[model samples]
Target: MQLSGLAPGDWVTVQARFTPQAAFLVAADGRTRTYAEGEQRITRLARALRQLGIGRGDRVALLAVDSPEYVEVLLACMKLGATYVALNFRLSPAEIRTVLAASGAQVIFHSARYQEIVDGCRLRDAIQFESGYEEFLAGGPDGGELPAVTNDDDILSISFTSGTTGTPKGVLQSQRMIKAITQSGVLELGLRPGDLIYSGAPLFHAAGFGHVLYGVARGGASVIMPQWDADLALSWLGSGRVRHATLVPSMIIQLLEHPELAEADFSGLRSIMYGGAPMPTSVVRRMADVFGCDLHNGFGAGTEAGGQLVLRPEDHRRALAGDEWLLGTIGRPAFGCDVRLLDPDGAEVPDGAVGVIASRGDTVMSGYLDRPDLTARAVRDGWFVAGDLAWKDQEGFLHLAGRADEMIIRGGENVYPVEIEDVLGGHAAVAEIAVVGEPDPHWGQVVTAVVALRDGHGTPSAAEVKEHCRGRLASYKVPQRIVVVANFPRNPAGKIDKLRLRELLAEGRIS
Candidate 1:
């Protein structure tokens, strides 16, 4: 076990169980950066971070896409015992500020494309790539002379989680937590050495970091798309070879929509894991059709000790064939993770009742970064409570209804907004959909859906959409209003921005 006195920057040692010769990454520039290259870059970057006054427990924001440099910064920060916050490059500068302010990051790094953006920031230092980075490293850090290895509080990262219902919270993950999640994920998810893992999520989230650790832990190859592009993703998948990948449901939808997809090859995919947002039932069907690989649904977050559940491919297929209900379920807990449902009173609820889902296991996070009250509320009685409400059937399969706060109280009836949203998400025109509670005089608060239509698709009027839902959902559950727009605002992790969605609705921006 890593005890105290473990410094991250100087005299730090991360003897990766996976070797450095392995092809670690395929960068956006089409350059293949191997594990050895990653290691060398990390060592150099450590020098750079230290030069910028980063120290153990200090927060540094890495705002970039899924490039080799992203992983390099992660390595440098971990080596220094500094906390690195991975910010989504897709976020607006204001949203980025929200995460940066929340993380208390002392240093910020950006790509050449975002130089102007970073230059405008009030950061102590906004470093760029290559020449700038090399010059920074050339300058001696506080340590002086050659780099020294040390260990401290392996608090390597403070990954922010924008829970579906509340303001974002930084989930504290140690070097050990990253190692633990990858170990279990590799084993349970069947990530093998020599396997090629296609990663599409923004490098800012825990799932993204998990891919890095998984690659390093197993000496695997990572096929990175700096940005999630469905066409490029299909091309990669079509160039058939043994591979694995992780994705969100939306990415899957785009892949299925690709004209070249049906003829493309999926035989190369050995394993595929997805779980960040809810998996729309219709999208799950499309997954079976387009990606004939061993696909599974993994339900997890940066909280509750990290990785919590896995719906194995065989189980997913079997369940789907036998009972369509499994389509919405996040499946059972992953190997070695203990999961259960708990009421607000901290008591276990019956199998069929929905309550806050809780987990206890090695894969759990250390705690919220520097927030004791928040930490205590999340972890109670040895169980790390995820604010999501879910229920398990008699067979032990878990169905994630939605977040506890996301549950709408309409005219005294408790309704999970996801249930109605899920029903409507199946429509052909609904490309992206987020359901939120809006002000309602009679019902106190009514369910509202802010939708983004598919490209070139004419958006259905609010009345028509409501009628469609009326056919499928109860009157109480139908969306009280619908806002058709070009795009729904998203957080770094690409989850719907309901917090801002609520703000827009409150301002009478949408009926």
Candidate 2:
């Protein structure tokens, strides 16, 4: 099924069950954009693209906030077998240049807000989103069916990971690969037709766009938030239509703290999904009680290939009943991925023994764009070793230890930073926190906690937080250094930037 020729003209030749009820997108303002209207727009866009020399198999990169237009362009590209590349708006123009250059995109459709950026990139050609969007749609070929001969193995996208190391890798997505993950994820979310699932997460990231597919697969409605906004998100949740949501732990903290949270009508909500990292157990308990909705939190290594594990709602409910330990476990291998817990020798370890979490599936990328050596190291024995350290229990739920690279080797004893972080995160004054390895002349690498505190609260000193962790974590696991900041630098997906944290340490600001 490996595709060599993927162009819109080709995919249109294939006949499959086309769902006419496909609602392309529903805006936050309650506008229903239909698939038929969207398809017409796509044809014009394809025609306009063709005029601009954007051909089959070409890359049409999008660098803008989420909207109905973004989805239209994506559908148009799909019609032509053109791979739609969604660029992260959070990245600096220079960082974006790296992606566009690496992607070899000929035409980039962007927002006017980024006019200066488009000018800075000095791209050979470009189109403004607001101005060109409608023009491209209305002017492209008054065409008959274009092409959509793409197959199951056709490459769909080149999604980049928001790495803590700052070296993002483009993980390729395939048609068949995502089909399986989306179906399963939709089921896990318990979405039904017309179920309003508000996704404020970045669409450029897997959680953002992938969730859209999950919603569509289940015949549900997905409401994109463009970016995270606590007040706006709460408005949607209280709007009575929104019945489901997926969030990162940090967002959960903000939502629960919002004043409206106390009175917000969450009666419509049946399930809530959380990931991108573990939420503090304290927050989880409060969410369960306050929202009166089932909390389904799980862990996964997200790459272009897709999600590796899911803590399904049923499993979470079962664990909440008695297996409280499952709160710390990442759950079992997902349907789409072949997971493994391997020791240094790449051999399987017994249940409860720590090892590296790895996965293999068609969803796994062919390779990181232009990083074959790195890809080789990652995809050994046909598995993408996610570089996350974890273990499986006898019941098969996975317990995340930490990032293998981030592990602090103290006097030869490895310590996980997550354990210390979970302890510090429980404090009332703390809003969000990340632990990173800092240079130490004695221990080789000492653990440091970089914290962002709750508003109107005084910052906790290093010693103050160490005392808090002392009771819950091992003595060696307590942070030796604490750095206070208003906010941590985040990638598009909202994961804190540890590389920037290292710079803060080198400047003697924290350590």
Candidate 3:
């Protein structure tokens, strides 16, 4: 039962040998791959990558939509001991370039749809999936002996931060870290053999890949969607094959809003795992009632630290019966994980006092890639400072107060104000700009930009400002509301007072 000594690829090899005919992956397009078939493809890919001069410790960047090829590349990297760099497809060309340069990725594998963007990036040794992938695999021998991956600390993947505050730092995750997360997920989420897990989140994100890894380790089948669609998800649920699903709160809301939901059958779904943002109590109640499935809510920082806290099924029942206070809490620290609320001086804070949430465990990332200074600042001693504000109640449940940084969570996507501010600062009519999140019913929050126009320039409409950002940033990062002001309030140090701006927005004084 121990999964410690084996890496993810090792597990895949074992599963292929023992249960070769079992379905391992089913794509939205209805293409299916068994455990043995997946291992064979990964073996071929590992050999191809080795022939291209990629070996242990080398970084391989993958920029593509969700597909079986994506998982193949990931496992291939794991088998070869090369670092996997998962690039977000939503990023603009400029953003993609920055990540490629920072990761020192010598080779990139991209989907055909993004070939134009990849060409624009001028990446060295790029392999396009449409035309180059099959030929690339043909160039190398298949089912060859590979190098041994014995070191637990060898970097397995480098997941970049959301870059909300500044440049996205690469979080270096090791085999040990991923193993810890897989074990924790299996135990905490009750993953079992033969379970059919469904996931719509992009594999570039930790939550998405982590779910797949969990299914692989448990010898279960996984159904992956290229993108989130309520109608497709409903159909999958009604098929009576899906037993578990990982989703964000926004997706749950959309599924409930779908007209077909009234007739959909959810009898096969045993559990629904949600996270990445807070879930409204009302929504949580309605989902449980409609599906009659256990609801598990998890909270954690990005890829750096895997899941830290998870609200169990029993907690949901208690909250539904009138202990409503538990609805806002993120339950207790997960098994094998340690969490603490520390003051600025790194001292533990008293219960019920807001403080920075820090965690340390086997699941924590090794460090930031090539950035020792940032690694030191983020990890003190052994704990990683989450940069999230929260307070623990008397019963030890953690209640999130707010973010210590100005990162916006728009429909589970992390949108940094600084990235948006940098893009808008170049506008001809914009004198000064600040971005913040405004509460929304469907999406947890919407990006709102408050701008101060130059004296001689004419005021720009909200649509005009958003149109200017359309090409420069991702669609989710574009400001939904643009508020023009003559001047911004400043603190004593002459810095723009963002706190004051938020207050004005809340009071309806700024629009």
User: Which candidate leads the pack in TM-score?
Assistant: 2
TM-score of each: 0.85, 0.90, 0.80
Per-residue lDDT, model 3, residue 103, is 87
For candidate 1, write residues 292-395 as lDDT tens digits. 77778888765447778888887877856877777767888887789889887888999899888898875677788668998898887668887888889998
What is the Cα-based lDDT of residue 381 in candidate 3?
A: 91
Which residue pairs come into collision in candidate 3?
none
Model 2 residue 177 lDDT? 61
User: Which candidate tops lDDT?
Assistant: 3
lDDT of 1: 0.72
Error of 1 at 60 (Å): 3.4
RMSD of 2: 3.5
* Greater-lDDT candidate between 2 and 3: 3
Q: What is the C-alpha lDDT of each candidate?
A: 0.72, 0.72, 0.82
Find the 10 residues in a row with the least total lDDT in model 1: 3-12
lDDT of 1 at 224: 69
Question: How well is each residue in 1-511 modelled by candidate 2, as lDDT tens digits?
Answer: 1122434222212211254455646787778765555556666777777777766567878888887777667766666567778888888788888877888777788888888877776566787878877766677768666666467666677777765675778777666666655655665666776576776676777778777766554555677655688888887787677778888877888898898787788788787888776566677778888777877764665554467777776776776688666677777777667888899999998988989988888667766777888888888867888778887877788888888878888767788877777778888887888888877888888888888888788878767776787667877778877778877777677777667777877887764
lDDT (10s digit) by residue, model 3, range 119-222: 77655589887788888877769664454474788999999876544677799998999999999998998989878898667888888888899999999888
- The candidate with the higher lDDT, 1 or 3, is 3
